[model samples]
Target: MNWQQAQKDFEHFLLIERGLAKNSVQNYSLDISKLINHLSTNEIRVSPTKITGEILQHFIYEVAKILNARSQSRIISGLKSFFNYLIFEGYRDDNPMELIESPKTGRKLPDTLSLNEIDDLIAAVDLSTNEGERNRAIIETLYGCGLRVSEVIDLNISDLYFQEGFIKITGKGDKERFVPIGEITQNYITQYLENSRNRVSVKKLASDVVFLNRRGNKLTRAMIFTIVKNLALTANLNKNISPHTFRHSFATHLLENGADLRAIQQMLGHESITTTEIYMHVDKSHLREVIKDFHPRSNY
Candidate 1:
């Protein structure tokens, strides 16, 4: 099959079969496009089913000059998944990427914001304007509930259980989970709902959406990132931050305060406890405290 048709089929497979998020699917698509670009630039005309690991290795070698180990690894991983799909569909015999080795890249810890930094970022929001209330609520939900940007944007008015002190989040792959909301976060969201959001004229489809644009449609993920970026600039904080920095800070802060990792995992909707365990590494002092407080023979 031609590169275009192969990529189109791969995209459909990822979305329909694997149920990957849009950004994730886009990343996989980008990797295949890069490979196609490499083949075209080198004047190597080869079909997807006929391409060998040797040509892929050559492409990897060229990419290694510009991409770091982590990026190279991700590209290799994406390509492998794509070709594996081809194999599963009976479009090819043996997987061409079977023998290809991904470059070794160590686990990179996510960046987290300090409590003071998070506070300053929220404090920087202009509360006088109509959108200001909405912005504050967005930050609070992100930090308080550890909601991903997509989850926050997709939040519905029906999903809020204020009396229960929890918010329902639709996470990756359509997984649903309940996350507890703090009093402060609840208050901010309530105020935004009662005041700013009430003023907006919402679209029919987005009537149940909690956060909305001025025109009352569901907010884009990019808008949330832009909000965080502007707030960072207004706060004059030097660290580069995003909506995710708040989520990381949420888990990290909870772990530092002796909250159970499993509980945090449930709230964050992480499928694996290993994903939640990264917070344990964030605060070594907490680990030392756990040893001193709980371990037997600590006095010795």
Candidate 2:
């Protein structure tokens, strides 16, 4: 099939068959679009089925100059998924990316803040303003429950179970999990919703959304980043922090305190324990302590 037709079909498959979210489908399409752009720029005319592994490899090499290792790896993965779909649909005889190797890169550990640093960051918020209160709740929920930025923004008031001491989080791929929320965070969110959020004239659609912008709309991912960056600057934290840092910190802190890895994996909404194992790497000293304390006859 032609590049354009293949892209259209791939999008349909992702949305209709795979049930991927719009952003995910867009990302997959964007990966293939990069190859289409390369072909157009180089004046090479070839259909998707006719494309060879060598040509794809050359395109990836060209792309490596513009993207970092992680981004390039993501692009390769996306392309591989797309071609695999095509193969399933009988559009191609075999996958071209089967032999393509992602660049060798170590797993970069996420930056984590200590409890005192977290308290300092929260204290730095200017509560005199309406947005400040909402921002406080945002940060608290992020750190307290180990939530992804998307999950935090998309959080609904109905998802909260303060009486049960849990908040239902809808994670990647629309998977839902209940995470325990501490009393401190629960009170902060309650105060923000009751005082600040109540004062704003929220839009009809955003009424259920827990966090809102000044215009009474749901907060965007960029807005969350801006809030966190400003707070980090105010607190004078040397560690480069983001919303994900809070999540990493939450998991790291829990793991350090001897929380079960499987339980943390469930709370973090990770489908596999392997993904949760990253936290083990974050605290080698904690692992050593565990080994010393738990191993039989360890006194020696």
Candidate 3:
């Protein structure tokens, strides 16, 4: 089959059989497209089933010259998954990326905000306007629930179980998890819905959506980023902050406050404890406190 057909089938598998999010599938497709573009540009004649490791290596080398280590690593990883999928479908006998190695980019720690900084950020939200109330609720839900930006945007009014103190989040691959919502977050949401959201003429498509734009439509991811950026500027936060910073802060703060790692994993809807363990490195003092308070040898 041609490279186009191969990539199409691979994308279908990623989206349908693998249940990957659209963004993830698009990334995988883009990786394959880069390879396809390289072959066309260089006038190389090889189908996906017949492509050799040498060609892939040359492509990766070209990529390394243009991209950083992290980006090159991601493309390599993405290509590896595509070839593996071809093998799984009996289109190829051997994987091309088996000998390839990713560059050693050490553990990149997530940036977190201290409690005082978080308070200041939230305080920066202007309460004089209806949209400000919605923005405040958006920020609160993000930090309070440890939700990914995507989850916050996809949240619906039906997901809020305020009486049970939980908000249902639809995370990556459409996996659903109920994370506990604190009273403060619940109150903020309640106020937004009752006062601001109730006043807006919501679009039918976005009627059930929890967060809406000025047009009463669902808020876009870019809008969320803009909101966070403006808030950071207003708060005079020196750190490069995003909506994700709040999520990192949520996990780090919980871990530092003696919350169980497994429990934090559940709350964050992380598929693995290893993913949650990154927060352990965010605060070394928390580890010291754990050892001092709980280690049997601490009595000495």
Candidate 4:
């Protein structure tokens, strides 16, 4: 099959069969696109079904010059998945990437804001404007609930179960999970809904959406990143931060405070405990505390 057709088919498979998010599917397609670009640039004519391991290895070598080990690893993984899909569809007999190995880039820890820094970031919001309460509530929900940027932006009014102390989150791949909402977060959201959001001229399409622009349309993912970026600048924080910093902080703080890792995993909507275990590596002090408190050799 042609590269273009193969890439299109792979995208459809990822979205329909794998149930991947649109953003995820696009990322997967990008890997194939990169390979196609490489072949065209080098004047090498090869179909998806006929592309050999040598061609892929050369392409990877070229990719390494432009990308870091971690990024290179992701591209390799994405390519592997694409070829696996091709094989599944009976387009190819043997997998070419079966022998390819990703670079040994050590696990990179996610950046997190300390509690005081989080407070400072929230306090930096301009409260005089109409969007002040809304911004405040947005930050509160993000940090308090440990929500992904997409999840917070797509949060719906109907999903708020205040009395039940939970918010329904539609996570990656449209998986739904109920995450407990703290009283502090609930109150901030309530205030925003009652004051800031009620005053907006909301669009009919975004009526159910909790977060919105002044035009009352649903906030885009870019807006969320901008909000966090501006807040970081205003707070005069030297470290680079984003909406996900709040999420990382949430899990790290919960782990530091002796919360059960499994419970944190549930609240964070992580499918695997292994995914949630990264927080364990964030705070060595907590681990020391555990050892001192429970280990039999602590007295020695």
Window of ten residues with lowest summed lDDT in model 3: 282-291
CA lDDT scores, all candidates in order: 0.91, 0.92, 0.92, 0.92
Where in model 2 is the C-alpha error above 4 Å? none
Instruction: Write the residue-wise lDDT of candidate 2 on 64-183 in tens digits.
Output: 999999999999999999899889989888999999999977899878899999999999999998788999999999999999999999999999999999999888767789999999
Angstrom error of the Cα, residue 132, model 2: value is 0.5
TM-score of each: 0.93, 0.95, 0.95, 0.95
Show how many residue pairs clash in every candidate, following the order shown. Answer: 0, 0, 0, 0
Candidate 3 deviant stretches above 4 angstroms: none
Q: What ranges in model 4 sit over 4 Å off?
A: 295-297
Error of 1 at 191 (Å): 0.8
Tens-digit lDDT track of model 4 for 1-300: 798888898888888888888889998889888999999999999899999999999999999999999989999999999888888989888888878899999988989988999999989999899988999999999999999999998999999999989899999899999999999999989989999999999999999999989999999999989988998899999998889989999999998999999999999989899999988888788789899999999989
* Model 4: lowest-lDDT 10 consecutive positions: 278-287
lDDT per residue as tens, model 3, 190-239: 99999999889999999999999888999988999999999999999999
Candidate 4, 48: how far from true, in Å?
Answer: 0.7
**Candidate 3: residue 133 lDDT (0-100):** 92
Residues 84-129, candidate 1, lDDT per residue (tens digit)? 8888999888878878888788787889998888899889999998
